[model samples]
Target: MTRTPASRRDDYPVFRRLQTRWMDNDQYGHMNNAVHYALFDTAVNGWLIEEGLLAETGAEAYFLVAETGCHYHSELAFPGWVDAGLRIAHLGTTSAVYHIGLFAEGSGTAAADGRFVHVHVVRGTHRPMPIPEAARQVLARLFPAA
Candidate 1:
């Protein structure tokens, strides 16, 4: 059986709103599981970019997704809107694990919850690099409990 969705909205310090697209739903009439990853990526990267921590094409520091997974609690279809809640679960020297919850607009409960783990690497060498100080500060706000 599919896992019940878990809400971490209260746990997250910030959220990014995303509008659904007609193509997001599958023939089954609900948003496909694949789309969850897209939303996760968009929320995280969008925040990173907006905070001036990430460069789209020419940054010395880059992040590569190392792991991701999601659990859905309810059905969400196309033309709907969602708020992607984000928080830092774990921050290592070169990797950060983020917890994410997707809430339907005006819904306090989460439609899905999951994690995104990314490993920071140097652009030229592709080797693990420590998280930049700037990004860490923005990310640290999410880690206040740490």
Candidate 2:
């Protein structure tokens, strides 16, 4: 089967720098596969919080992870830093698909790439809700041009 080429830093519009913890490494001496998903979650949610789109508490609406996926191109080990590049692949009324690329610091090619799907929902009810206009505006910055 053919494989999609790994993404590059230039493909994403926003980035978050994250440090790999010692515990992140597995017996093989490389970062465990699960950590890649954590980094992706951190990058996207951290961006949202920084942009004032999400609140840690008492928010009327917030996002919940509906799905996640990853493709590894190389190994990432602990005692290093990673740059997670993010972009919006799809924007719907109540959900958004995020594309993330994890690259070693100062590297142009991605070490891993992944997709995260978030569903906007009411805080208490947890019912799907339209993405807030304010949040949409901020998210638009990372969306690809028409």
TM-score to native of every candidate shown: 0.90, 0.94
Highest-lDDT candidate: 2
lDDT of 1 by residue, 1-146 (tens): 66564775676788899999999999998898899999999999998888876666987878999899998888777888999998989998899999888999888888899899989998888799999777777788776343
Where does candidate 2 stray beyond 4 Å?
A: none
RMSD of each: 2.0, 1.3
| TM-score result, candidate 2 | 0.94
lDDT of 2 by residue, 24-129 (tens): 9999999999999999999999998889877668878889999999989999998999999999999999999999999998899999999999999999898999
User: What overall lDDT, based on C-alpha atoms, would model 2 receive against the true structure?
Assistant: 0.92
Residue 77's lDDT within candidate 1 is 77
